[model samples]
Target: MLSTVSPRVADPNVRTALVETAARLLAEQEGLTIRRLAHEVGTSTMAVYTHFGSMEDLRRAVRLEGFARLAAHLDAVERSRDPVADLSALGWAYCFNALANPNLYRVMFLEAPIDAEEAESGGATFAPVVAAVQRCIDAGRFTSCDAWSLAVQTWTMVHGMVGVVLAGVFGPDEMLGHLSTMTVSLYVGNGDSRAAAVRSLARARRRMEPHAPIKRSDGAAEFERPRIQNAAP
Candidate 1:
């Protein structure tokens, strides 16, 4: 009979360290080698093998970790009285997740050879956006269009802007303001009244009011989101 056993990692924390270190290094465009990774995590190269099976597996794990973090942020957006406001909050949460984890964000989307499994798994992260859009449609705030399609459209617009900001095309300080502008246009076009869309946008922005773009020592600006309470699953 064949034995079924998972590999034992002497230190579970080492696995987390390896994944995070590799993601940060990959984002910084550092030359990644097994020895370098091991050195950074203060473990032998064998630990990587024990934890992830191989470097390719570790890369996939890193991408999955990025999605996990993103899902957490989306799940943090509570359902509000207005479905439109709730939808806007979901988009903001997605953007804030990327801003907070630029390194992981790059690894999640920019890396090549995205396998079928990884791609499918990553698609799950968009579920909340789709559900939120459906709520808007059900509430008669949006036209009777396909919810998934609109959600994808919204995601594409937001992700494109985020990618540009991450590439230093512009400062992150203007991101929320720009998102508000674009989403209002999108919502209005999809049958929502402009006044109601603006109101929803304002409500969403207010939730993140505790945070603003702050400059790092390197003088780069980044947005921070405060912890929201009573978030629905």
Candidate 2:
């Protein structure tokens, strides 16, 4: 009787190693081939399919991982007592993160699709910016504007600056930091004194009111009470 050889199942460690190798390749080349990647990883195209479903899927995973790292950078910025300062820090973090991870950064903001469904389902990869924008609004640093719109605006400004830097429109060290600062300044609108006073008053009122129960709105609990809180006398 002839002996039969059994096929090996893909190990998680091996799969992760392959993915990491692919991510590195994508980062370096920006346009990498699966055949080349498979050869580098000593795996078959079938293995890549089995592990990541498709090349698109793998790219999405890589981009998502990059966004997670970027979010962590933003999170590390100190929570400033001044909302404007905090907002500035958030914007700075966005630009810095992109500069730090040029490959992953390009994938996250520039290479991704602009479809509505993709935007809605992009998961944690996209949530950090929205959450950060909401935080600024909640802190009364930004006027009462839709968080989604503000998030897009902030993203546009930061991403535009990063793009200019990456495209060699300017030297990497020359105008990058200056452009980032200017972008943040434009977004914050020269520190409106009247707006800041209004925000302070609103915050004071919110803190004095008792916590109200959330009500069901279209199957979701809505916290109707204003978010800003006043200090105790």
TM-score of each: 0.86, 0.59
lDDT of 1 by residue, 1-233 (tens): 99989866467688789988999899998977888999998998888888877788888998888888888888888998899998888887777778777888999999665788778767888888899999999999999578999999999998998999899885555666677788999999899999999888888878854544455788544655433332221
The Cα error of candidate 2 at residue 211, in Å, is 39
Residue runs of model 1 more than 4 Å from their true location after superposition:
1-10, 211-233
- Taking every candidate in turn, the Cα RMSD to the unseen true structure, in Å, is 5.7, 13.5
Q: Please report the candidate that would top TM-score against the real structure.
A: 1
Off by over 4 Å in 2: 1-31, 42-47, 112-147, 187-233
What lDDT does model 1 reach?
A: 0.81
As for candidate 2, its clashing pairs are 207-230
The residue-by-residue lDDT of candidate 2 on 1-233, one tens digit each, is 99999875777876776666666676566466778777888888888777777787787766666767676766666554555445545555665566556666666666656344345444444466677567767766667577788777766776677788767685434443454345444544623354453443334233322222233554322324422222211
